[model samples]
Target: MFLFKRPLISALFRRKIQYPKSLNIKPLITFQINKMSTTVTIPEKQSVIYYDKTGGPEVLQFSTDFPVPSDLASNEILVKNRYSGINYIETYFRNGIYPASFPYIPGREASGEIVAIGSDVKNFKIGDKIAYLGNQNFAQFTKLDSNKVSIINVGANATDDQLKLYAASLLQGLTAITLINEAYNVKEGDYILVTAAAGGVGLILVQLLSKIKKAHVIAVASTNEKLNKAKVNGAEFLLNSSELSYDQIADKILEITNGKGADGIFDSIGKDSFEMDMKSIKRKGTIVSFGNASGAVSPLSITRLSPKNVKIARPQLFGYVTEPEEFQFYTESLFDLIKNGDLKIDIYKVYALKDYKTATIEMEGRKTSGKILLEIPN
Candidate 1:
């Protein structure tokens, strides 16, 4: 009887026992099979905006059936972009102020999900959310090198608002952080002037210098409405450029600093504001000329900087964060600032992917202040 009872128990264990449906238990083998079966369907063709020749915003040609990029290099991952950010740099590329190959697709940064990856990619996997800095992002899909991408570090159930914030912040936020830290090494108590202070990078720069670096920030914008936005982000002083000539702005900055001049001048207006920067910067100050919004600065004699012993920099965002580690460091710092409420993302408008031309027009025409974003349709 004991042997028969033992055999019965062994047979019960050997037979596949069906758990009650209420138990909601999945077999290990079944789970493994389902996992292996999971695959992302990558579309062969995708909507894109591209231009064969550089010109105005009118040059951008959008199509619904542009071929999606394929054949990822070993260190690259393919991303299905959810949102893309617009910057003055794209205008540079589009208008031929910055060099690019013909038939160029203009975009510098985007946020997306990894739909596929090359064999060598281990740091990211299918379905990973990421914000990446790369070119040709005005499309449904972007194939990017692993080094340029930062995985979005939000909750498992992150909302669209959270994702959009990261998308809007990545490029301009990193630029602002790197500008203060590397371009000029801003210090607490230093008097810093940020031109275009309510624009995308400008507002962030104001906040970083004032709120994070504890610097006295003088915000310069074309209108009082824009200056007010800058003040809300922590600028201690506001100067309306529309109301003040460059000379007057320079005089005001000097007055604010008690005739000492600003220790650092962050200028994005390029040609139009270069002289103002020279006049407003203190001796041994650093002038970071980062954008060409008012058109690129013309050549100046290096001797122009010698009188004040002022240092000048024409730093680009990519130049400051070339290494993967450097990129990760600044990216993490930016994210932390947002998470802690130290940095606020101000998105002026989010345009449909097809409406990219209008977005670019508004951005370049200074019709908008704050980050401009494009929503990529599925």
Candidate 2:
């Protein structure tokens, strides 16, 4: 296995800030008040797409009529979201692929600007550009905790709203870093297999492992186009996942390794690919089952984890970000990498917030390459 950097030093972890907040960057709600709803026009209220009974895209509805705060609470920042990033997770929320509390709004990653700051909030002021990750991201104006946002500087060419919304590209990077760093403690010389290797988090994970963890990334994808995406992300090898049986795919990995299997496998396509992952992993290998794109896996058995001493565990981004130390330890590196060009995020499609059905259709059809954004009209 290939590795980079030696005697890995302790990395400083940073806490997560915010996302949908990264979309619309409003000017300071107040010049000197330090807090309060920036006192804006249009009633300081906005629109959001929501669903009561979840099933399919048709179940979604655009709501020009939505609720806004009667008062800004302490430590809260009212963000005027311009564009929100639509993710597969949101689709799962909407389509009931993953069950949620009824009548919940979807959309997770968004970038915006501060419009209102609670009186007790000091870390941020109104009008600052920020990116936030949380529920209720489909809303035009989102009130997020002051501490859950990250300040961003827009380029000269991009408007404040554009820049802030673009910041949502970092969501997968943040998630990927957290997944690799904590969920597995992935180390140098680790030969990791990334399934759905061309998808948002999959590509980001390949990049992080290649650039940060210095691991050998063997990317597995269903299409050549996706394989190319993995290639750009620093994949050491690419395996086409089409027209091949699970056993044949495992055989290919062994061929690539001269009979030795991968050290770690990140399986996202749930049941359709879980058994293959088990066959391809090396002895004492680790399997990080993250998503169930194909369908969730079945009951676990001791035989699945025994004999080879293989370690299998499922970890999600929310699991890591809830902790301050782990959150910072991972996310800070993501931004730094983006600023320095060590990572890349595709802004493949932008949709109007009301057009969520269209976005979800394209996303579920696998007709996209990177994070899709929903622009909430200002």
Candidate 3:
């Protein structure tokens, strides 16, 4: 009886079994695995800001019944966002200067906790706090690839407010670090000019250049109050653009540099400052244009850079940290700076989620100085 049963089982296992072609298999497999995995009850709907067309800030519409995303792909994790950072790039998308799909959500980074994760995800579990860089973060829940998520490992005893500060600082902090390291390497004693020096990225750049890289920073801003703020952040020289014309600012930069222009110029005010950048940068200097606040820089003849033998770079933060290892290295470096008191994060304001439109308007108007954030209600 035992021999007969053994042969019968072996034959059955050896037989080829074919699944029906009409049956979708991937979700079925995921469902079977999820039944055995850890998960929390997630809401089916969430509050979100979305737009079907690109225009001014008025195009954004808030909805409390927007569907929550549940169909996470194999390397994705679902995050219940607590805070989202507002950036100038979002305004570019809203104004149609940057192409985006309709029904688009307009946020780039957020901090949250993992509520659900796909079967193949590793090193992360449900309920782990994280801050991630991804799109569609204006919603309460965001689906992100595991690679884009960074665990909030500030400390075991860190408070919720401290975590929120980390979230607000991540995107802009990473941008500043990469710009100084990769966009143009800032050497010790390098005369660097940072435009828009009171903005989110500007303040970080000023700190990294003066404090970390040991370079002399010449900060440029639109107002004296803003310049004072930049000075407190470690800028050695301050140029008030509102009080000085572009050429005058260039002249002052040269005058401060002992008749030689700045060795590097980091310009965030796009078209309106390009001429000033060209004039302020010294021979063999590099110009790093990383934003479009005043407007996109117009086309120029390549030969224009020939006279000074200058190097110009247009770098985006995402381009510099595409690999997971690159992201981790820069993120860890940024957090280390924050932890050691080498970098200070200033939150301009934390607006309620409903006030996203007002936040956008204020940031676009250049009325805010530091990082702007939106609080996502649980």
Clashing pairs in 1: none
> In each prediction, how many residue pairs overlap at the backbone (N, C-alpha, C within less than 3 A)?
0, 30, 0
Cα RMSD, each candidate? 14.6, 7.1, 13.5
- Model 2 residue runs over 4 Å out of place are 1-37, 42-45, 147-166
lDDT of 2 by residue, 1-378 (tens): 001111112342222323214323232212222346465563534687888987877888888878865466676777777677776777666666788886677867677767777776665656666666766878888766555533332322446545543555656767677677666767787888898888878888888788777889998888888899889879998888786777788888878766778888888788888888888889998889888777678878877788789998888777766544334434455655665687777767778888888888777777776677788788
lDDT, candidate 1, equals 0.79
lDDT of 1 by residue, 282-320 (tens): 999999999998999999999998989999999988886
TM-score of 1: 0.86
Q: In model 2, what is the error at residue 281, expressed in angstroms?
A: 1.0
The local distance difference test score of model 3 is 0.80
User: How does each model score on lDDT?
Assistant: 0.79, 0.70, 0.80
- Choose the strongest candidate by lDDT: 3
Against the true structure, candidate 2 has what lDDT? 0.70
TM-score of each: 0.86, 0.84, 0.88
